[model samples]
Target: MAESSPVRFGILGCANIARKVSRAIALAPNATISAVGSRSIEKATAYAQENGYPSTTKIYGSYEAVLDDPEVDAVYVPLPTSLHVKWAVLAAQKKKHVLLEKPVALNVKELDVILEECESNGVQYMDATMWMHHPRTAKMKEFLSDSQRFGQLKSVHSTFAYLGDTEFLENNIRVKSDLDALGALGDAGWYSIRAILWTTDYELPKTVTALRDPEFNEAGVILSCGASLSWKDGRVATFYCSFLANMAMDIVASGSKGNLRVHDFVIPFKENVAPFYTVEDSWFGELAKSIHPAPSEQQVNTDLPQEALMVTEFSNLVGSIKGEGSKPEKRWPTISRKTQLVVDAVKASIEKGFEPVEIIY
Candidate 1:
């Protein structure tokens, strides 16, 4: 990667989620999308032209070419969930900082390999669990940690679901490929666990029980799942993830004095939907809409994509690397390890007729 003025980014693939994050990257204060790579040169060139990028913003016919490009300082890997670790290690080996799509890897072993590769190559890497960087999530963490308010929380309940995407379903990437490393567990459950762990800072669970629909093939890709978590600290969380359901996302925290519920836990709306010009605005208003509003310390509300926040945070981490900010911590490893524990527990439970499996982390 060349040392340009601002950080230059090359996208590994033109996946749809990559488009969503490309917008975020464009909005990022310190990043630039210098190139996009696609298996098809025509697709890459078309994406470059349609996205209003400079023609010099190279459109490579192969991912490896993009990695070899001198102008690309970082790469966003939005490839299939199965290929996350494979390409992430390659990107790091190419000396490119990576912002990888979630579930970081299919399993604990793959995640470890990716992390080890990044460390050996001295490249920064982050799983794209953007919401943890959101203001609301941080505030929720503070509120949960407050001994006076919500002390020693008993349980966390959360859900994330959506109607299956037409193309994704027909092609059945969710059910067919090795890249389909997980079903709802990898897709939505990751966020539910994120909300629970990030908010409460609980030790990873000791046990998990999961049930899935038989037709889903891989136990990970289920129409719906119900799982129970027993954390090491005696705290518990119950979470659900589904692909057959309409978008109904929620997270609830029950503590000693009061309870807090996050409606639309995944995507909080900032601006109300408009007739013709529906802008994707901030989520503050929606987040604050029906707060219980505790007397002494108020509940918090903010709507921001986790990706944007995560990117900003990563940028700060990079600056810190250059002695421009506080040193970054090994947060990604912790997050990856805990998330994989949850994933493994769920898979084990489903395989064993919903038998409870102890959480190793």
Candidate 2:
């Protein structure tokens, strides 16, 4: 509640996502990792130690214990999609601000309840969507809004896919039976929806439909589904997501005058190839060059730390909460609305045998 105070963040899980976010929280200004909770105390303590966090950061055996700590000013929930709503509401009820990861919940109904709880508690509630906070997306939005580059926006097509490990498959929470609906749609595919909604000012279609292959791994939990989202203005966007395959994770936007193609749009600049963009007069004018991998100068394997964009953004939200006026509240209404709409549409399509369903927003 104090204006000049640094916000204390207590993470709810020690999953891989948590490691990346924790690093981000450490880098962001005026944010501190006061505590971290995991299902195992040893795991929590080890994570805290390995990550260079203060030893004073208490390790809790349960998430609820972290929420109950008076020192924790805000909570970050990176649990499975179905569990998001339950823990979010509980955090709000405890009077803690929340930065929940994507999908927020499995459906609109769950999200509505979480939103209601936040409103009732008078606490800040945000979906932890780093793409929305990235500068590249802002540039994309600018180009999409310009009349010359984007007049009468016609279509948006996106693909988000990656391969999963079998060993990880053995112990991962993602493969659990209790979290049936928390798959690629709720995970990576949510990025496609976020992109279209944010770039198009949340003008989406009334109907949506999906086709999926159920034989895959994460696909079994949440299928690799593609959807055709039809807008009221006759503008349609196509979306694709998969956890069983590897894709470039590209997002292409087509309009009347010109088109924009972004490869690795979701994790753009996070790793691998440098996150730099070069604008060209035409997309087809580009040539692909294949270079053979040169042998390493040293016969040693190197490790690069993971990206913490989510945690950095969450910390910024905390700083905003302590700031005079936060713009995320006034500006993020469209994000919240569109997220629910896209999620609802996708779930409906999956449940009805990939039938075309209408979006209420």
Candidate 3:
């Protein structure tokens, strides 16, 4: 790989999310789409054409073909949760860096296997948590870290929900027991859990207790659920995710001296700019008649969409390994594992009739 050449990415599926990511790869200056694969060669070819992939982009009938392509330096895996471990490990074994979709695995154990394969093969691995790459997220982190403004965190709450249509409720792979068994927890709650952990700098909670009476489909798949996480220092966080509510994505964090709120945490309502709210040193006037200084709005602008930024970041890491012979970045895989670990704990708590599950790591 030449220093001047862009990192070559091979997409492993024609999943809907992959369409968005393919555009991001095209937008990223450091990356380019090299190939796309599906079980059906015609589908792969059509996807490439429909997504405006370059004429040189290869279309393959199987994921293995993409991994075997010498020109491909990395693979973007948008496969379902059940297929992630197999394809991700195979990609790593082929020495191709992996950019995996969110809810990276069915469980932490599976995640560990994927990570081990990537480590042993010296390939970069990153989960597609695009919001982490957003400029607004960094700005919000700065506010949260300010001791004078935000003080010590006391509590946090996050929610992500979207009402599913009849077709989706009946046919979506997300609700399929054999495909995405984790259901809404893995799809929507993954973002909420990651957001909560991000506020605490990825610290594992001491315990997790799922809210009682989770709704389920006929196949025994979760349709809606919530959980509470408690830290040893008394910091508490709660999150809810569902496919039975109007679309909403929010995170509210309260501290000793300040509070923060964001209405759009998963995907910004707008692609170019994102806004958040915060209030510092809030107090009431005499007789609690009036509040002093209302919450302020902060907006951050981006040159490219967050997903593109994510691709650029992952591609940069792959480029370093390919061009400079550098070691794979550990930060990505570490955060991904921590997120999965917490997710598993929440699922365990639900299975145990909402009993509190202690987090070991």
**Which candidate gets the maximum lDDT versus the true structure?**
3
Best by TM-score: 3
Q: In candidate 3, which residue pairs clash?
A: none
| lDDT (Cα, 0-100) at 24 in candidate 1 | 74
What RMSD does each model have against the real structure?
6.8, 6.3, 1.1
**Candidate 2 whole-model C-alpha lDDT, 0 to 1:** 0.70
lDDT of 3 by residue, 1-361 (tens): 3355899999998999999999999999999999999999999999999999999999999999999999999999999999999999999999999999987999999999999999999999999999999999999999999999999999999999999999999999899999999999999999999999999999989999999998999999899999999997989999999999999999999999999999998899999999999999988999999998899999999999999999999998998898889999999999999999989998999999999999987
Please give the distance, in angstroms, between residue 77's alpha carbon in candidate 1 and its true position after superposition.
0.5
Q: Give the per-residue lDDT digits (tens) of candidate 1, residues 64-120.
A: 898999878788888887888778888889888778887677777788888888877
Clashes of 2: 2
Task: For candidate 2, write residues 1-361 as lDDT tens digits.
Answer: 2235667899998767777778767765556789999889998888889888877898998889999999997888888776887789999899777878776777777887888887677667777776565555566677678786466677888888776677645555555546636566777778887877765787667888876643346336664667888777867888787766776577777777656667767765445232423232333323635323321121111122223444555556656755655533534535775777887787777778888887775
Of 2 and 3, the candidate ahead on lDDT is: 3
Error of 2 at 81 (Å): 2.5
